[model samples]
Target: MNVSVSRNSSHSEPRSLLAGVLAVLVHLIFVAMLIFGLNWKDHPPEGMVVDIWTELPQPTREPVKTVPSKQEPKPVQEPVKPKTEPPKPEPPQSELPPEPVKSEPPKPAAPQKAVTTPPVKKPDIALKQKPEPIKEEKPDLQEQKKKEQEKVKEQEKLKELEKQKELEKKKELEKQKELEKKKALEKQKELEKQKELDKQKELEKQKELQKQKEKEQAIQRQREQEAKAQREAEAQRAAQQAAARNLVTNEVSKYKALILAKIRSRIVMPPDLPGNPVAEFNVTLLPGGDILDVRLSKSSGHAAFDSAVERAIFLSKPLPLPPDPALFGEFRNLNIKVHYRE
Candidate 1:
């Protein structure tokens, strides 16, 4: 479809349109070149359109023509007329005299300033206006002797101090030994006193047993001489006594009024010995009238009083028992002691 247009028509005007096309075409070519080469691999798929707008240089106005400065014409100078004269003749090189000689005196060497340092004032070395000679140090002879003497003196002082300390230590040890010996002697005395008391108690117990045995023998002999009826009667009497103690103690709380009076009448107040001594003791008696043993638990200081107490205990052997079982154990060979007051 060719549409031919007339000259000067807007559609037929190709120059302006060609210029605009050329500008766009040039931009597209540049972008295509960048995408295909520099940035092609990094941005493979997307066509990165970059607007690279640049500012073009501004058009400069042409300089206006300036009138040149007119310089003043130099004065017209006439050629100088040469003087008409014969030239002066030059001196011959061989005949010329030597140049005037310059006078120079020999230079004296520069004088040196005096280089000596000023003497310093020396320190005063004299001792109080006394002209005593300096004594040489007796390093080899006198000092050795002095040091030896000092060493000897120091050694002697140390030895004396050591001896005094040793003497004090020995004295302390002797005192300790004496104290130990005294303690041992006191312990020995105590043990000896205890042994003597034990011997005395044993002897007293033996004597009491002998006396009880004699009394029992005499009673037995007397009973043997009596007739059968009389023996039976005596046995009955003993049996009654056995039951009496039982009946009394069994109802002791009820009959305490009667028992207290009976005990008080029989209780004897022994004589007072010297010391404020107390002997606490215990004993267990058998059914028979024989004392099995007498034990002294605590010892009174007085020997005669303690012995007397032990003797009393043995003499009161085989303490009466209650007939009934309920009251039997009340005084059945149980704990007791000899109680006496002055």
Candidate 2:
């Protein structure tokens, strides 16, 4: 159980750990929900009421004054003039016959007395009674035409001013609409920029998380490989130790036979050797199978034969040793006996 736990812990990924944590949290939330009931109903929104009351204006009352009473006019009394007595009737004179007068001869009559007559003076009343000059029809008509032209010019000027004002108002409205459109476009662009920025941030975060996960997995794999290699090394070391402890003599003999065969193949013997003789040699070897020394322990009493054996040993250079380093002690100073037969 403990080994299984350790193995699971070593191989578990972050995703699995997070899932387990989430599962626990979900269970806890479920239990909490069961213990405490939820209140899901929403409260109703409050309403506002507005009342409008308007009062009617009162009528104004004027002050009343008493009027004076009218009086009846009195009748006028005219003064009476005394009536004058009629003038007395004039007396009538009786008519007489006309008398005939005789003609007088060439008598100069005396100048009649000059009668005195009052001088009559004419009244001189000064009054300005000059006759008014007659007005010309042509000049009056021209003046009327000038006044009509001035009225027409004033009406045209008023119309032009109204047109200019209308045009200005239209231009102002167009400018306002354009400004609103520009502001809307700017707001949209800003929103798009913000959205792009958020997307970029999210992508970067995901990339960082992926990279971290990969790094962790790589580290885990490295640790597993290292552990496996260590285990293998330990097992190999133990096997080697066991094999060294149990050294087989037959295995040693096989190595010795291989060494002898190698040396014999390189030996150059002389034909004049008398009888078949056996030569014995003690060879000192290193753990790596390199010969340190070769000394003649027993000889066939032939110098040439001894010399040939020495030369053969020298030519062999590095001798064959046991494969196991622990068994190297057996071949450190190996003794070999060789026989040459004709």
- Given candidate 1, what's the lDDT at residue 97? 18
Model 1: per-residue Cα lDDT at residue 35:
78
Worst 10 residues of 1 by lDDT: 111-120
Candidate 1 residue lDDT tens string, 1-342: 134454336455559878999999999999999878786467466767766633211111111111111111111111111111111111221133121111111121111011111111111222222122222546555445545644664575456546555654654565456446645755564565455456546654664565456555555655565657688888999999889866675565443333333323444435666646666555554544345666777777666666766666565544444334455444434444334452
Candidate maximizing TM-score:
2
* Tens-digit per-residue lDDT, 136-235, candidate 2: 3455654565446445644654565465556446545654554466457556655655665565566546645654555556556666777899999999
Candidate 2 Cα lDDT to native? 0.59
